[model samples]
Target chain A: MMKSWDPRIEEMPKEDLQRMQYRLLKSLVYRLYSFSPFYHDRMREQNVHPDDIRELTDVKKLPFMFKRDLRDNYPDKIFTSTKDELVRYHVSSGTTGKPTVVGYTQNDLNTWTTSLARALTSVGLGRGDVIQVSYGYGLFTGGLGMHYGAERIGATVLPTSVGNTERQIELMQDLGATAIACTPSYLLHIGEVAEKMGVDIKKDTELRTGILGAEPWTDRMRTRIEDWLGIKAYDIYGTSELSGPMFTECVEQKGFHVWSDIALVEIIDPKTGESLESGQKGELTITILQKEALPMIRYRIGDITTMDDEVCACGRTHPRIQRIQGRVDDMLIIRGINVFPSQIEYALMAIPEVGQHFQIVVERKGALDDMLVRVELTKESFSDKINDIIQVRQKVEHRLRNSLNVNVTVELVEPGSLPRFEGKSKRVVDKRSL
Target chain B: MDTQKFVIRQISIFSENRPGRLAAIAHALGEENINILAFSIAEANGFGVVRALVDYPEKAHDKLFSLGYNVAFTDVIAVRMKDQPGGLYEVAKVLGDAGVNIEYSYAYSGKEGAVLILRVDQVDEAIKKIKNSGATLLERSVFH
Candidate 1:
């Protein structure tokens, strides 16, 4: 009756989840009609009143809001709280389009940071630990995000907003930074710079833990980062959309805890529009159970993943979800074949010769969609063997066909040829010229 | 569209994602005395073509392959011109006028002159006007 990921939330029992869910849901339902014009009109159109739901069984009566709705409403539109109380602003990546902005008030900031602190606690970062934040300090969530949590934990905070490679390493070493929060890629870059400066990152002083997120990374990447820095790397899963760093892997490293205190999590069929049972992968949706400035209900987060009530090996009583595979927006359909670019990234990263610099070009030829993958050599001063390029390309094609089961043309490029990114990198190009 | 034919000897080399692929190619070029005057790499889908203008490109091809790389040579035209801004636009316009679609292109120039490695829509005619215009279509060089 007890599963690995269930004990944390499972022992609470259905009655408890429902009790807390509806209590907040009742408040959220009221607020939807009270403050949010979209929800107010929506609930009216659905003709559903809060009292109509006798139990959590009627949670479905509440409407769902997708990312597109957020994009259309954007900033200042869907805000439930007035401008006076709004104190913090977080942004979603414009990867799919213009980034949507979300605002929070002082109380919301406290709740958000408290939630982040819970995530931080999962990995054992607390008071006195000097945490270096390398995520970009902008409208983006990474920087100020882990910052608030580090403060919440009373850890000495270093808001090292992303890269200035020389300065980052200098401060990292000089400050004896005990914990670092940044994208998994940037951390690797920092390690590279540290090695070149004759500072063995592995032998370096005091950095004991890393909170890496902002981009989806594989377990291989986890090992890669941890091995390079000689530190325990914990995965932090969140976005500006969800108030930042809601779920994080505990020291037990089983997976990420759902941080259910602030947000309610559910998995549902992206197509069927029905919530899926545990252990099934689907579109993730959440209700902002605790928020003042902007509370979203059944907000459809385009991230695709699974959830479970199974107890975690980590002692936490909250349930855990697997690391997100990738965003639904990142999906590519070439020749009517579904492909996730992360799959290609995985295949190419597995290849020693293929550098992280990769580009996918999708063009339509006649009635067929042709997708090409261009992987560059790691650096200049390096030449590719024609045989190796062909072999590697062939291997990549094989992997792509076998894994995503899509046909793709693979090209091997010279080093420094692919476009680079200072922030979240773009991976696919729809070169259909439409 | 039948133009003067100039062999560029494009070599397709396979390298992994790591530091030092260019160095290996440069080393081979230096050993063979193949002068890479004008070279460009068209990169996408992880593979790129290393097109170069050398003194004896045929010999460069042999040297690259012998160095344990799978190298292939394709004929291309290297058009020389006065080093200036519109020189490229002129070339492209001329090629475009002749209905030559550019499959790929890379350019390199120095104080003496500029050379454009162009894979044109119409290779033969474009080369004739280019050669007639006094542009020396340099051979793949051992002096690269």
Candidate 2:
């Protein structure tokens, strides 16, 4: 691992990275002018021509294009290259009316694979390993990105898609997978299934490592997963547009290793438009530099992250990022307090008897948002004394007040009552009557 | 630091599996206005033993016996511990090699030091061994 593809590129001393970034920005200004109608019209209105932009410092001159603009443009208006050059296409397909379609050029695909490969390797998965890609296959980047990375690493790949928990167990046991990849929440579901079928996940399965991502989780969830699954769970950081997981958890598991070799991540204050210093939390904006075909420059992704220039315990010199707290879109601003549903979910995870199946109900009450968390009791919990269950509920509600600093009502429902997702789990139900 | 102050009492409590066990323990001492300097619990296969070293050693002994639940006042020291991993290791390793077994122990966070409630096989001998090992023993001043 001495001096990755370009040590100076990965380590490109902040000042040097700035110099190279400006050089790349100049090219972005030219490309945006040529291909994107959205950017071409904006640059003209701002009187900011490609020629006026000299270096990376001139990034401020480029007007930001948001996810909305991409959605409004739909299939091809936001695309820079021709449909023929677009080797791959993925859509957001979120519950929000319109799904943003993003296309990738052939070279863009290569950069994505390299980034995904780096993430897989960060978790110690390489040649002679068996990786079961359990993330869904089409219209989503998680499955394919993991598929190709396992392929690139020359490891055996098992495309298990999403559910069929019983079959997943059958394959995991029969195939003897060394590493499993999927959402952390779904992994817990599988853990429950194994317990029901009387399979000791620790002894029955040869699973030594797992790469769980595509959803945000807490450190408490990490401990629960490790103890339950009997494997070290590494968080894989990715998005459909930014070419899949750019960061992967190293052995230290403190923070994620940013694939800075190909991508440049900058944490900037949304209001001031200034780069927040290392270790401060803010909105994250990314620039896809050096992708021969589809190059993105200073694109704001709206992800909130804890960024620091501190060197990690893993010995990599690249800047590391804390696991994403929540998307700016996912945040619920209740009476001016920023509350991510993941934070609520994390509070629920701390109640071990409560397990992972839970939902957050956000409602407007007297000009303020009132929170209610409804969690399902595990079979193991039901078999225990009834009085302990009520105490757990009280503890969960009390902890939510301390952890979230907001009042919450915790309700314990019977098992199998809450909805489980075959796709993405919709845990947050916002019922604000504005 | 030994005979001049403090009393170690083994307080037995019958706690039904319910909320406010810790709160009840806090309230029981609150009624008598006696302060607990250090405490620990060792749960049997069924019941739990709550041992406490309280301030107003004589009053705490009278208060627990009056409440009634097989409470015994014994000779136990309030040993000091560092809030670190090897901190426990050093004490445990020394007593282990000395053939002195720590039967059960309890702990609570303190402002200056983490207070330990240890029930060892040899109380008087373990106290001397712990003091010689350079560990500080807390006094009634903590409860007061």
Query: Which parts of model 1 are misplaced by more than 4 Å?
Result: A1-18, A95-97, A331-434, B1-144
In terms of lDDT, the poorest run of 10 residues in model 2 chain A is A1-10
Instruction: Tell me the fnat of candidate 2.
Output: 0.00
Q: Which candidate leads in lDDT? A: 1
lDDT, each prediction: 0.70, 0.69
User: Cα deviation of A12 in candidate 2 (Å)?
Assistant: 5.7
TM-score of 2: 0.56
Scoring only the A-chain of each prediction against the true A-chain gives TM-scores of: 0.74, 0.73
Q: What share of the true interface contacts does each candidate keep?
A: 0.24, 0.00
lDDT, candidate 2, at A279? 80
Clashing pairs in 2: A8-A12, A22-A56, A279-A308
Which structure among the candidates has the greatest TM-score? 1
- Where does candidate 2 stray beyond 4 Å? A1-19, A291-295, A331-434, B1-144
TM-score of predicted chain B, candidate 1: 0.74
Per-residue lDDT of model 1, residues A1-434, tens digit only: 11222234434654566587778778778767877778888888888887876776577788887766776777668887888888878765332324568898998888777777777766777777899998777766667878888888778998888658779888888998999988776677778778789888767768989987766667887887788789999888875667766678878776787756567788888887799898999988888788877677788877788887675665565667777775656765443233556667766666675586789998766424578888765433233233444666677677666555457787766556679888777978876532
Question: What's the TM-score of every candidate structure?
Answer: 0.59, 0.56
